[model samples]
Structures are given as structure tokens and as C-alpha cells.
Target chain A: MHEHIQPVALEKAYRLLNHGPTVLVSSHHDGVDNVMAAAWACALDFAPPKLTVVLDKATKTRELIEKSGRFVIQVPTVKLLRLTHEVGTRSLANEPSKLQDTGVELLHLAGDTLPFVAGCSGWLECRLVPEPHNQATYDLFIGEVVAAWADDRVFYDGHWHFETAGREWGSIHHIAGGHFYAIGEQMSARPKRGG
Target chain B: MHEHIQPVALEKAYRLLNHGPTVLVSSHHDGVDNVMAAAWACALDFAPPKLTVVLDKATKTRELIEKSGRFVIQVPTVKLLRLTHEVGTRSLANEPSKLQDTGVELLHLAGDTLPFVAGCSGWLECRLVPEPHNQATYDLFIGEVVAAWADDRVFYDGHWHFETAGREWGSIHHIAGGHFYAIGEQMSARPKRGG
Candidate 1:
């Protein structure tokens, strides 16, 4: 059921991140893994979809992501608010691994390349685009998205249907102090170009 | 009336952007000025209040912002949807800049250093922190916010009061195709660390 959603076009993958939901950065390397929350990420480019996420130098996820040159970002729903806070606050270094620290279930990709949190609304597999200067100076890393997927029940046909019947998937955007604002009330504005 | 709002502590300023609203990047350089719509920006650091915004190399606003080394990000309200469309569509390259392209009432600081749209609920005045690698490779510009302000009616004492009486100043989050989701209900998640 999790794999039912088809891959999003690399170009359109930026849309999944367009609205700025807080994401859980997941990565694995050499049998070691890490996960952490990051609100400092945004679409860096459109085609060949690229994204920039800040990972502080002192994080276990940063070490794992840098070592493997790949990572996955997942948009968790409000239902995972407790888990989000749990995973975000604790360091993998303290517990030796995220898998042991929390009750969150993880699904490893074929060949055990990287891990993705189960029950996430959206997920993107990305390979690092090396930018050492930004990484060392700002703790920022750029990634070129190679694969993308989302729960079709929540996103499909290039649009998000949080209102779809029997579908209650809504992306979570963390504000401050463990507070989150769930995506709500979709409305469209006509393109002002044809005037 | 958009002039005065108590200064926000730099570290806490990220809270303002943590929710992820599309912002209007307003900048001026050598007497020329421009404003463009941007949904690709996020709070990067806490202390010293740093932010990262993706600016297309082709955008006139990017050129002006790069030259000025200063830009103000204004968080527009839902009431400015038409103005947002107008600003997003019209480029600064052609005659009549976004300031004039849209009928937005401009509010300028006394020093003329920072300017903001009158209807916006929050504003951040940032000084560029040059990261040439990210800029040349990814068109990402990093800025350290020096001063920040917010409309007391909507944001006071670091909490948004959109639920208050008389005025409802909801922030706009851009999804794609000029479509946006007005910021909806606020929900808080307690710290799982202590609880």
C-alpha cells in the first residue's frame, strides 16, 4: 500500500516542497542510520529537482548523510507530532541509533541504501550535490532528487487532495516549541499573467 | 502605522518563518528597486537569525538583491492575493516595477533602509552573508536577519493572534500555479522530551 503512489516527475518533485512543511531527514550508511527534523529546507531548483537543507555540523544525521552522499526527506503528518518531537529532540549519538530510541517504524530501501519512515505522507530520495564551501561554512547541503513518491491517497495527478474522501493526510509544518500548524484550506489564485 | 512593532529577539525570529509563508523579497540598489514573490525561503539558523532564499539567476530582483547585499522579506496577508499575483507576474525588467505594477501601498522605514508592504503581518530586514559557492552553483543566497518587526494586531509578544477580533491577518503560503493556502488553524504539540 505504501508503494502504490507512482514516482513524481523529477521536475514536479519541487512541488511537494513548495509549501515548506517540516521534514524528517533520514539517512543510512555502513549499517548505521540517523534521522532528525529539519525546518530549514526549501526547493533549490525546478528541473532535475534540487533541494537545500541545513544540517548542523554536530548532528549524527549530518555525518550519516555526508558519508553516504544520499538521504531521504519525509513529510510527516500531524498524527506524528509526538514522534516528530521525540525524534527531533534526541540525538542518534546518545542512543546509538534512531531505530532504538523511538517506536517509529522504518522501511529500508532495497539493498539497504537508505531508510524511510513508515506512514509518511510524502518521501523523496536524493543524492548529494557536493558543495563543500556551503557545507563547511553554513552547514547547508544541496541534494538532487533522484526518486520521489507520495501516498496517492494524499497526492496524485500532480495535485494534493487533503480533502479527498476518506483521506486524512495533511502535512505538518512546525512553528516553534514543538508547536505545529497543519496544512489547511486550499485555495487557488488565477495566474495574473494574461492581462 | 506599519512602522513600529517591538523588536523581536534574533533567535526567536526563526519562529516567524518556521511556518513557511511565501514572502515578497523587496530590495533596492543604487536607486533601482524591485520586489518578487518567493516561496523558496526558510529559516536557516537560530542565533543571529540567518535565512536562506532561493533566487533564480534570471530574476531582476535577484540581481538587485545581490548588488545591494540587503533585502527585506515581507510576509503578505491573504487580503493581498491580487497584489501578490500582480507582483509575481510582472518582472522588474520591464517598465513599472512591482511596486508600481501592483497597487500595493508602500511603507518605508524612516532611515529608508528597509521597506515593506503595508498589509504584511511580519517583516525581516536581512544583510547578506555571502556564500559564493551556493549562489553560483544553486542560486541560493543566505542572509543574516539584523532587524525584524511584526504587526502587533496579528503578532504580538511572539504569538500570532489570528483568532483575535476585528482583523484576521492570515499569512499566505504558495503551492504552485499562483495557488496559495492561507495559513489555517494553529495547533500545539507538547515537548515529548519532558512530557
Candidate 2:
């Protein structure tokens, strides 16, 4: 685990995905692990924090997730854009060890065997919620977050503090092809009275 | 409809919500109309574009969506953040004429009677895909994008061209409380070679 990583409160886990950054889904099953990039993921609930992510029917990650019923969502930083795009474009079924091909390292959390992509700003370890209809129909999987962690350099105290983390720490929001936008320019709005 | 608004290809419609900006869901039923803010929404499919959004069962927007089976998703710019946050905090059930109270104008698309929030960057007119079990169990709603439009000034040729739209035109990404981050800083990555 990275030295800056720390446990995120379960209640506040949704914050990790609230901004809608492109995430890398990591799954391990039967001694085989695979990672794939996904932009179609978001927070689905607040308190017993839950999230939904799309894993296309043909992807190896989807197969691994189904068999193991576990996956990790890793929010890649701007610095990892190349690796993110690489993993997104190539399939593990085609490359067989795609993570190794991209030169992206996988790190295991303390006392946990599941693999998480290195150099990510946040990690959400999720257990599949078993909505078979949704999975079969829409390629969507809903998961209840069992544990969450974040790199304190960019996230802490239930908020993303990227302003001080330097440009490389900003999260990536993919557009299409290899294009992406780095999460930027924080602002706040005041609610009107009685609103 | 704004003169600058033009049709967006259904195949590229997912780009509207791909980055995960906060959305204003407007619906009309039995001569009554309502709009609500949703932060939990994302693209679910590509070809026949589909998206999912969470509307708590208690929300009037949910009731309107259920009754009408139709709704419009408006991607609000940073300038509309206050109004977005306002509608999100107040329920139309309590205020009755909440849209009028917020001072946000509603404009009708030429051939459609449905109401769409003006001053937004993109609009997606959708018809609900009934998933009773999902709706009841998770407050989740799925909609297939039937028609879509975008402000040519901000989006054209199937991509969000926010760079030239000025700061106020950037889409807003909501965080907890009233804070938001304006979508910012475009970048691209190079795809690595195959394994």
C-alpha cells in the first residue's frame, strides 16, 4: 500500500466517486487478475455507500467479477492517463497479462489479497449486490462498498483537496478515444432562502 | 429552443453525461411540470444510448417521471449552479410552483410540449424504460435517449467544446453540500502497443 493511503469512512465513501472521474475496475479470481478502465461508473447511494459500474459482457473483468463477486474501483490520476487509456483499449482476453504489458503495478492492501492499481488517488473495494436482471440486461453491476481508501495527498476529510496536490494528482474524466479532461476549478454555490 | 441548439447523434449522446456533470431532470404530467437536480447519473450504453439516474422514491420528480414516462435531462452550466442546487433542495410537492419560484425559465422545443430548462448546455429527451423492481428497490430509473440537442457554442461535432465557451459555460460537477467543480483542463493520452 502507498504510504499516503488511509481508510475512508464508509459513510463518506460516495465522495470518492461523486466527481465522476474515469475509474479502473480491478478483479481477481482463481489466481487470475485483470484490470479495465471504465468511465460509466457513479455513486448510487449514500449511507451504506453503494455504486454502479458497467462491465461490458465480453470483457474479462466482467467475467472475473461475476465469478469472484468482488472488484475494486481505482480512480486514476492525470499522471496515469497513458496507462489508463492503454488498459481501456486492450482486453485481457487478447493480451493475457495486459497490466504487465502496460507496466502498471498492482499493490495488495495490508492483510488483503485483492489487487489494486498502484498510483491511484482512491480505491473502493466492492462486493457485487447480485442484480442479475440489471447485469444481463444493461451490463450494469451494483456493488455495496465494503472498504474504501484514498491517497491523503489528493483526498481527505470527505473532500477532494486536489488544489494542493499539484497538477499530476488531478483525476481524469475520459471523453472518447484517448481524450480526457482533468477535474479542475473548484467552486461553491450558496442556496437561496427556503430553497 | 435556443437558436444555437442543434441535434446530437444518438450514438454520441452519451458524451453529454459521460463526464458525470450534475443534471437537471425536467418532467411534465397531467399539465403539471417539475425539475430536479441529479448528481447520480451516467451513460449505460452506446448504440441505443441509455442512462440511469437515481431519484429517491419520495421526490416529486420521481412521481412525475413514473406518471408521464417521459423526462428531459438538461446539463446545466456553471452559471446555473445556484438554480440547480436550489431545485435539488426544495421539493415541488411542498412548494407547488417550485420552478417559477426559482426564477429559472422553461422553454418548449418547437414540436414537443415537454418543458426543458433554458440556459443549459445539452438536453436529452428520454422515455423511461420501466424496471419496476429496480425502481422500487433502489430508487433507480433507466431512460433511453430518444432525441438529444446541444448548444453548438459548447458542444459540436459530438464533443464538448467548452474551451471556447468561457468559464460560465463549463458544466458543473456537484460535491456534497453546495460545492462544485467546473469541468476543466482537457488532455489526451497515447495508446501503448499491444502485448
Candidate 3:
């Protein structure tokens, strides 16, 4: 792990994904490692943090996750935009060298065999909460976050510091077809003024 | 509908939420209408679009959705920041006049009874898909978008025009509490340069 990487309290893990940034989902199975970009991941619960990510049946990363029953959902910074899109478009099934070709450098978190993509603002290590109906019908997978970490330069004290972190550290939100928007200026709402 | 509000193609409706903006969810049942803010809504599929939103069991809007079997998920703009936080915090169950107190103006879509917040950038009228187990266990609700529309000034031609739509029109993404970040700069990746 990088010196800047720090563990996030499991209780506050949902905050890492609250703002809805496009995430990189990585998994390892049978000596195989894979990563792919997903725009449809969302925080599903708070305590005993759970999240949902839609993994298309076609992606090799999804197959790895099904076999390994563990995956890492990482918030990729603006600097990784090209890498994110490349991994999303290319398939590990067709291109066996996809990860290396896309310039993905994997970093391990101690004892875990799960592959974590470096340079992301945050990483959530999740154990697959198997929901067969959702997976077979909707391609939706649920995971209970067992552990989480953040690159404190961009996220710390249980919140994201995108404004202070340089533009390259901004989390990217994908709309479609290689297009994305980096998270922008922060605004605070006035306390319960009415209603 | 406002002059700028135009119907969005059903196939392109998923693009409206692909960027993951904080949305205003509204529902009507038994002569009552209510709206609440949700940061956890995400597009589930395309081509007869489907979406998922987390509605706490405590929310009155969720109750209405359960009874009526329909709800509207609208992407709110920066202009509605205060309203968004206000509604999300104040429950209609306790505050009988929550909508009016928060200055929410409910607009109707032709014959539809669902209340659409007036100033949102996009509206996705959804039919509850009724995943009872998931809803009960995870407070996760799935909705298939039946009809969709977007304010052409901010979103049109199947894309978000945040840069050209002015700052106030930008989509707001909730972080936690009353804090949020607006959708920022638009970016496009250079087509497939790597392996």
C-alpha cells in the first residue's frame, strides 16, 4: 500500500461512493486478475456497508468476481480517465493481455489476493453478497464492504477533498461513449431553514 | 411541461442518469404527493431503461411509491440545492406540509398524477419493478423508466450540456449531510490509443 493510503472506517465507507463517481471494479480468480470501469455502481447501505454494481455478462472481470467471490471497487481519479475507458472497452476474454496493454498497474493490499488499481482516490474491498436472482436476471451484483482505504491526499477525515486535491485527483463520472465529467466545486446547504 | 422540456427517447433515457446525479424522487398515492432527495439512484439497464434507488423505509415518499406503484426520479440542478437538502432532511410523515414548506412546486405531466419537481434538468417517470426481497432487506427499489424527458437547455441530443447550460443548470451530487458538489468540466478520451 502507498504511504498516503489509509483505512476508512467501515461505518463511513458509504461516504466514499456517495457522490456517485464512475468506479474501477477489479477481481482475481485462478491466478487471473482483471479490472473494468463501471458507471452504474452505487452505495446501497450504511452500517455494514453494502453497494451495488452492474457487471455485464460479457466482461471477464465479472467472471473473475463470480469465481473469486471478492472484488475491489476503486474510485479512479481524472488522471486515470484514459485507463478507465480502455479497460471498459477492451475485453480480457478476447485480449488476454488487456490489463498490461491498458497500462493498469495492480497493487496488493497485504494478505488479499484481490487486485487493487493504484492512483484511485479510494478502494473498497467487498465480499460478494450472492443474490442469484439479481445476477441472472438484471446483471446486478451486491457486495458487502469488508474493508476500505482511501488515498488521504484526495479523501480524508471521512470525506472527499476534491476541491483541495489538484484537478488530476478529481473523481471522474462517466456519461457515455468515453465522455466523462470530473467532480466540481463543493457547496454546503443551509441547515434546515424550512420544512 | 415547460417549453424547454422535451421528451427523451426511451433508449437514450439511461444516459440522463449515467453520470450519477443526485435526484429528486416523487410519488403520489391516496390523494397525497411527496418528494425526497436520493443520492443513490443509478441506471440499471438500457433499451427499456431500468434504474435503482435506495429509499429508506422511513420515507413517506417510499410509502406513496409502494401504494401507487410509480415514482419520478428527476435530476435536480444547482439551483435546487437548498430545496434538495431541505426535502431530504425533513420527512413528509412528520412535516405534513413539507413540500410547500421547502418551496417545492409540483408540476404534472399531462394526465399523469405523479408530482414532478418544477426545475429539475430531467425527469424519469418509473413503474416500480417490485423486487420485494431486495426492497425489504436492502431498502433498494427498482423502477423501469416508462417515460422520460429532459430540459433541452441543460440536456439534449442524448447528452448533458452542463458547460453550455450555465453553472446554475449543472447537476448536483450529494456527498453527505447538506454538502454537495456540482458536476464539473466535460472530458472526452482520445479513442483507443493503447493495447
Candidate 4:
């Protein structure tokens, strides 16, 4: 499949996460790469567009990310819903190689040599900000977007267009008990006037 | 309004965040309390029901939470949508008290002294699990749910019945520019057969 990488103004980078979709954290080290599904990520700051993600102490993705100093978060499409669950619960620690177990397709975008899940709608390639305290105590990793890209067909001009896409492009919000909530019913609220 | 506080098993607490709704962080210090809206809150654990939230250093709510060692996360209903944006951008640090500016009705649940915003669908009252490193570096706070309660009118048996009698009890998921999405459309996918 073909792809394009757009330069999202650092200030606008927060828009990627403002919607709160469960994402796959992808990392590469020593020519090996892996992706793990994470439902615990949020926009931590604007202007510079920073994000904080929780990488568990036991996950191989965290180890690889620490060694490589870079990781990419891919917003998985609806078609990969089951795959998201597979990656989230399976431990890379248990299996030396997860890519061998989970059959999820992979894609490489932009300057991100790290491989991303093929069915994702957007990708944020991040460089680790090295918050040792947050990482050790809270499993929180802060990153600054080095490069960002999205499937323009779905996300463009700062708005996620889920109407045109099929489940393969629909974002997944995972609830517990193996259930997930697809981004549903769109509505916009104007800012309340003059408090 | 009549309300009930039911105990939710710790393992299932992630359901509170599964839909990704913006929340009001309420805290009290020496009898002075404050509430602020946070669009960036997410689940960090399942078994222990840990949560990760960002509390700006400049905010009074943060100070109170640090001093009091507790805070409550209240998931507001669609009815409270009008007041969501008001608390987020306006800091209690400037105003003498947030309660005055927000005009949001507050109720103190039994067993927990922190105020919870009435009309909200659920409430998670947590004790600060201080990680000084994470706090000093990223302004990220981690809390373990010591007590949790939900308005059963909306949540029961592990799912939100917004379409039923609790129609207006849907949780508010905010995107950007004040545009919010009420938790819509719920689907259940049974876990695939045993490996």
C-alpha cells in the first residue's frame, strides 16, 4: 500500500490525540521491531504537542523503546479490532517474537524506520523525552512528535473523517472484558459564551 | 437529586475510562475545595484500577490534591456539557474558589469528603500515590482508587444504559475546540474461542 507523511504544526499535534483512540505503540531496536496496543495514552501538552503514554514495566515494547529512544503510536482502524486485543494482552516477554504469533499486517511510514500496524488510520512518530522519574514510577513515557502522518483519506485538515471509511479506518476505543467502542455518533459543541 | 454509591470491583474500574470522557478533578485542602475540568484522563491499570492524570503545577486543584492526599474524578453527564469548557480553561488559582465560578452543583458522597459534581454519571475517589519523580518532571499524577461510586441510574452490571431511562446520563468525550462526543453506540464482541 502507498502512504504520505504530512507535517502537522507542532501546535496542532495535540489534535491527533484529542479524540482519544486506543493506539498501538511501535518500537524498533537492533533491527527488531514490535507493536503493542495501549489504551493509556493522552495529549499531555499543546504548543509543542507532547504526549504521555504508559508502558508497563513488564512489556517488551517498553524495553525496546528505552533502548531505541523512539516509538510510534498508530491509531488502529476498526478492522484490526481483534488484532488490537491480541497485541494488548499478549506479552512480548513471554514470546521472543510477537510478530510471529499475531498475524497483523505491518507498514513503515515517513522517516519512521519503525514498522506500524498496516490497518491504522494515522501515525505519530515520537522521540522519547527521557523523563526517568515518570518512566520508573508511573510507567509514563513522554515524547515529542518528530514526524507525523495520517491516511489523508480519513484524517485531514485537523479533523478525523470517519464517515467515509470502513471499519479498516474506523478508530477503536477499548473497554474492558475484550469489548471495544468504535468512535460513534459525531456531534460538535460550540464553546459556551461569556461565563 | 437522589443518588446511590455502589462498589465497583477494582478489576472492572477501567470501564470508568473505557469510553474516554473528559472528567472533573475535585480536591480539598484544609476545608477549601476546588474542581477543574480535565480532558486528558485515562486508565493505566486493570487489577488495581490505577489512573494517570495531568495536574498543572499552577493550579489550585493540584495544590489541594497534593496537600490533602486525595481527589475525586467525576464523569459528568451530557447535561453538564455546558460547564465542561468553563472549568478547564479557568483556573481556581485566579478565582477565590472554583465552586463560585463553575456554579456546578456539588454533593459529598458518604465515606468520602471530597466533593463530587452532581449530575455526573460516575465518581472515582482516589488517594494520591505520589511519585515525586513523575510529578516534578511531567506533572503527571497517579492515583489508586480507594473508593469508587457511580450513579446506578446510568451504570449497572458493567455497562452504561444511556438509551434506557438514563438517556441523559451518557458520559461526555471532548474532542477539540469545545466539540464533545457523548459516549455513543456500544457493541459487545465475545472473546474468540480458546486457543
Candidate 5:
């Protein structure tokens, strides 16, 4: 694990994905480590944090997740924009060195066998909540987050510091084609007038 | 219907939500209408665009959706920040005047009774694709987008011009509490290196 990486409380894990950002999905199965970028992931629940990510049937990452029943969803930074696109469009099914060719590096967390993509500001280690119907029909898979971590510099004290952190640390949201939008200015809604 | 609002092709409707933004969900049933803010909405599929939103059982909007089997998911702008938070937190079940008190204005399109938040940048009218087990277990609802529209000034040519449009036109993404980050600078990934 990177020096700056720190564990985020399980209750606060949902905040990591609350703001919709493109994420890198990684999994390890049968000695195979695969990573892919997903734009359709969203936080599903807060307590005992859970999330949903749409994984196309064609991706090797999805296959790994199906076999292992575990995967990691990580928040890719603006700095990883091109890498994210490359991983999302290209495939390990055709290219044997998809991860290496796309400049993806994996970080292992001690005894955990799941592969975590490096350079992400936050990560949620998930256990697949099998839903055969949803998976086969919509390519939608649900995962219950068992552990979570984030870089102290970018996400500490229970919330994102994108406003104070370097721009490179900002999370990116894919628009269409190869275009994306890095999360922008912070705005706070006024507190209740009369509760 | 606002003159600036234009119909978005069904095939291209997914682009409206491709970049994850907190959405305002509105529904109508019997003689009642309701709207609520949701950060858990995500694009589920492309063709015949489908989406998933987690609606807590407590929300009046969810009840309206359950009875009507229809809803509208619209992208709330930075300008609707306070209104979004207010609608999400206040309940029509308790506060009968929630919508009016929160300054939420609605725009109806011809025959449709589903309330569309007036200032939203984009709107997707959906018909519920009922999945009983998922809804009962997860409070997750899936909808197939039957029609869509976007404000031309901000979203035209099938893409968002948030960078060039007024900052307030940008879609807002909730992080936690009432804090949010507006969709930021546009970044394009480098073109594919090779086939």
C-alpha cells in the first residue's frame, strides 16, 4: 500500500462514491488480475456500505469478479484520465498485456489477494452480492463494501478535500466519447431556515 | 415547456446522465405529486436507456412512483442547490407545503402529469421496469427512459457545454451533507494510439 493510503471508516465509505465519478474496477481470480474503468458505478447504501457497478459482459474484469466474487472499486484521479479511457475501451481478451500497456499499476494490501489499482484517491474492497437476474439482464452487479481506504492527502477526516487538494487529485466523470469533467468548485447549501 | 428545452433522441438520452450528477426524481399518482433529490441515480444501459435510483421507503416520491409506475429524473443545477437539499430532506408526508416552501417550480409538458423540476438542465421521463424482489430487498428501482430533453443552452449537439456555459448551468454532484462539487473543466483523453 502507498504511504499516504489510510483506512476509511466503514460508515464513511459511501461518501467515497456519493459524488458520481468514473471508477477503476479491479479483481483477481485464478492468478489473473484485471482492471477496467466503469462510469456506471453508484453508491447503493450507507451503512454496511454497498454499491452498484455496471460491468459489460465483454470485459475480462467482470469475468474475474464473477469467478472470485470480489473486486475493488477505486476513484481514479484526473491525472489518470487517459489511462482510465484506455482501460475502459481496450480489452485483455484481445491484448494480453492490457494493464501494463495502459500504464496501470497494482498495489496489494498485505494478505488480501484482490488487486487494487494504484494512483486512485480512494478504494472500496467489495464482496459480490450475487444477483443472477440483474447481472445477466442488465450487466448490473451489486457489491457490499467490506473494507475501504483513501489517500490521506485527498480524502481524510470523512470527506473529500478536492477544493484544497491539488487539481490532479480531483475525481473525473466521463461525459461521452473520450471527454470527461474533473469535479469542480465546492458549494454548500444553506442550513434549514425553520426546522 | 421552456423554449430553450429541446427533445433529446432516445438513443442519445443516456448521455444526459453519463456523467454522474445528483438528480431530482419527480412522480405523480392519484391527485398528488412529489419530488426528491437522489444522489444514488446512475445510468444502467444505453439503447432504450435505462437507469437505477435508490428510493428509500420513507420518501413520498417513491410512493407516487410505485402507484403511477412513472417518474422523471432531472439533473439539478448549482442554482438549485438549496432547493435540492431541501426537497431531499423535507418530506411531503409531514410538510404538506414542502415543494412551494422550498421554491420548487414545476413545468408540465402537454399531457404528462409527472412534475418536471422547472430549472433542471435535463429531464428523462421514465416508465418503471418493475423488479419486485430488488425493490423489496434493496429499495432500488429501475426505469426505462421513454423520453428525454435537455436545455439547449447547456446541452446541445448531444454534449454538455458546461465549461462554456454559465457556471450555474453546470450539474451539481453531492459529496456529503449539503456540500457538492459542480461539474468542472472539460478534459479530453488522448486519441487511441493504435487499432
Candidate 6:
């Protein structure tokens, strides 16, 4: 694991994905690991944090996740935009060594062998919450976050510290095709009245 | 509806929510209408577009949606940040007239009494796909896009045209505690290999 990576409290795990950036979903099973881009992931619950991500039925990542019952979601920074786009467009089944081709280093965490993308801003280790009907009907998988981590430079204390972390560390949001938008200026607003 | 609002192709409706912006979910039932801010929303499928959004069981918006079996998701721009934050914090159940207090105008569509939030970048009219288990267990609602529309200034021809659209028109992404990041600069990349 990266030295800068710090553990995030399970209750605050949703903060990692709350801003809605595109993420890389990594899964390992039977000595095979695969990573793919998923823009359709979002936090579903707060405590005992749960998330939902759409995985195409044909993707290798989906197969690995189904078999292993676990997966990791990594929030790729702007610096990894090109690599994210590259991995998103190619499949591990067709290019068996696509991860190597993309030059993305995988880091083995202290306790788990499941590898996480090294340079990401945050990581969410998850255990699949089986929903066969949803999976077969909509290709949606729900995962309960088992553990979470974030690089302290950009995210710490359950809040994104991106204002001073620099633009290169900001997360990427895919628009369409190969186009993406770097998360921009942060602003604060006050409610007009109390509920 | 606003004169500038134009119909979006049903097949490409997913693009509106693909980038993952905080949206205003509006539903009407029993002569009462309500809108609330939901950040936990994302595209669940591509064709015959589907979306999933989290609405806490306590919310009146959830009740209205369950009774009416329909809702409209409006993508608020930077201009609506304050209103978005205000609506999110205030609930119709408490205020009863919260919408009027927020100063957000509602526009009536040609053939439906369901109101759409004016001044938003895109609008998705949806019919709920009843998933009893998911809804009861996770407070999650799934809806299929029945009609879609977008502001020509920010979206056109099935793609987000935010590059030419001014900053005020860019979508708003909620971080936490009233903080938001306006959708920013667009960048494109090429995949290293084909799928």
C-alpha cells in the first residue's frame, strides 16, 4: 500500500465516493485480477456504508467479482485520466495483460491480497451484497464497504481537502466517449431557513 | 416548459446523469408536489435508460413518488446552487410550502400536470420500476426514463456541450455540508487498444 494512504472510518466511507467521480473497479478471483472503469457507482447507505455500481454482464471484472464475492473501487485522480480512459475502453479478456500495458501499478494491502490501483486518491474494499434479480435485470451490483482508505493529501478527516491539494489530485468525471471533466472550484452555500 | 428546453433522444438520455451531478427530484400526488435534492443518483443502464436514486424513507418526496409512480429529475446548474442547498435542507413535510420559500419556479409540461424545475440544464421524466425488496431494504428507487429534455446551451445532440456553455450553466456536484464543485473544463483522451 502507498505510505500516504490512511485508513478511513467505516461511517465516513461514503465521503470517498459522494462527489460522484468516475472510479476504477478491481476484482480478483482464482489467481486472476481485473480492473475496469465504472462511472455509475454511488453510495447507497451511510452507516455500514454500501455502494451500487453497474457492471456489464460480459465484463471480466464482473465475472471476477461474482466469483470472488469482493471488489475494490479506486478514485482515479486527474493525473490518471488518460490511463483511466484507456483501461475503460479495453477489456482484460481480450488483452490478458491490459493492466501492464496501461502502466498502472497494483499495490497489495497489508492484510488482503486483492490489489488496489496505486496512485488513486481513495480506495473502498467491498464485499458483494448479492442481489441476483438486480444483477440479472439491470447489471447493478451492491457492495457493503468492508474497509476504506484515502491519501491524506487530498482527503482526510472525512472531508475532501482538495482546495489546496492542487488540480492534479482532483477526481475525474467522465462525460462521454473519451471526454472527462476535472472536478472544479469549490463553493459553499447557506440555507435560507431551517427545516 | 421553458422555450429554450428541447427534447433529448430517449436512447441518449443516460448522458444527462452519466457525469453524476446533484439533482432535484420532483414528484406530485394528491394535489401536493415536492422537490428535494438527491446527490446519490446515477445511470443504472444505457438503453431504455434507467436511474437509481436514494430517498430516505422519511422523506415526503419518497411518499409522493410511491403514490404517483413517477418523478422528474432536474439537473441544477451553478446558478441554482443556493436553491439546491436550501431545498435539500428544508423538507416539504415540515414547511408545507417550502418550494415557494425557495423561490424556484415550476413549469408545467404540455401533456402532464407533473411540474419540472425551471432553470435546470436537463429534465428526465421517469416512471418508477417497482422493486419492492430494494426499496424496502435500501430506500432506493429505480425509474425508467420516459421523456427527457435539456437546455441547448449546456446539452445538445446526446452530449454535454458544457465547453461552450458558461460557468453558470455547468452542473453542480455536492461535496458535503453545503459545499459544491461546479463541473469544470473538458478533456479528451484516446484508448491504447480496442476492446
Candidate 5 lDDT tens digits, A1-195: 478999999999999999899999999999888899999999999888999999998999889999999999999999899999999999999998998898898998635788988899999999999999999999999999999999998999999999999899999999888999999998989665696
Question: Taking the tens digit of each residue's C-alpha lDDT, what string does model 3 give over B155-189?
Answer: 88899999999999999999898889999999987
Model 1 root-mean-square deviation: 2.7
| lDDT, candidate 3, A80-191, per-residue tens | 9999999989999999999989999999974668899988999999999999999999999999999999999989998999899889999999988999999999998865
lDDT of 6 at B75: 98
Model 1: residue A119 alpha-carbon error in angstroms: 1.1
lDDT of 4 by residue, A29-89 (tens): 9887788988889888775667888898989999999999989887887778777888888
Model 5: per-residue Cα lDDT at residue B75: 98
| Over 4 Å off, model 1 | A109-111, A165-167, A191-195, B163-167, B191-195
- What tens digits encode model 6's per-residue C-alpha lDDT throughout A79-136? 8999999889999989999999988788876377787998899999999999999999
Measured against the true two-chain complex, the DockQ scores of the candidates, in the order shown, are 0.78, 0.84, 0.88, 0.58, 0.88, 0.81
- lDDT at A42, model 4: 89
Per-residue C-alpha lDDT of model 5 across residues B117-150, encoded as one tens digit per residue: 8989999999999999989999999999999999
- In the range B106-160, model 4's lDDT, one tens digit per residue, is 7888445688888777888888999887788668888888767777777778766
Scored by lDDT, model 4 comes in at: 0.77
Instruction: State the displacement of the C-alpha of residue B87, model 6, in Å, after optimal TM-score superposition.
Output: 0.9
TM-score of chain A of 5: 0.96
Q: Which of the two candidates, 1 or 4, achieves a greater lDDT against the reference?
A: 1
Runs of candidate 5 exceeding 4 Å displacement = A192-195, B192-195
Give residue A61's error in model 4 in angstroms.
Answer: 1.4
TM-score winner between candidates 1 and 6: 6
- DockQ-based CAPRI category assigned to the predicted complex of candidate 1: medium
Alpha-carbon interface RMSD of model 2?
0.8
In order, the Cα lDDT scores of the candidates are 0.79, 0.90, 0.93, 0.77, 0.92, 0.90
Model 1, B28-69: lDDT tens per residue?
788876777899988888888899998888788888888888
lDDT of 3 at A62: 88
**Residue pairs in collision within model 6:** none
Better of 3 and 6 by TM-score: 3
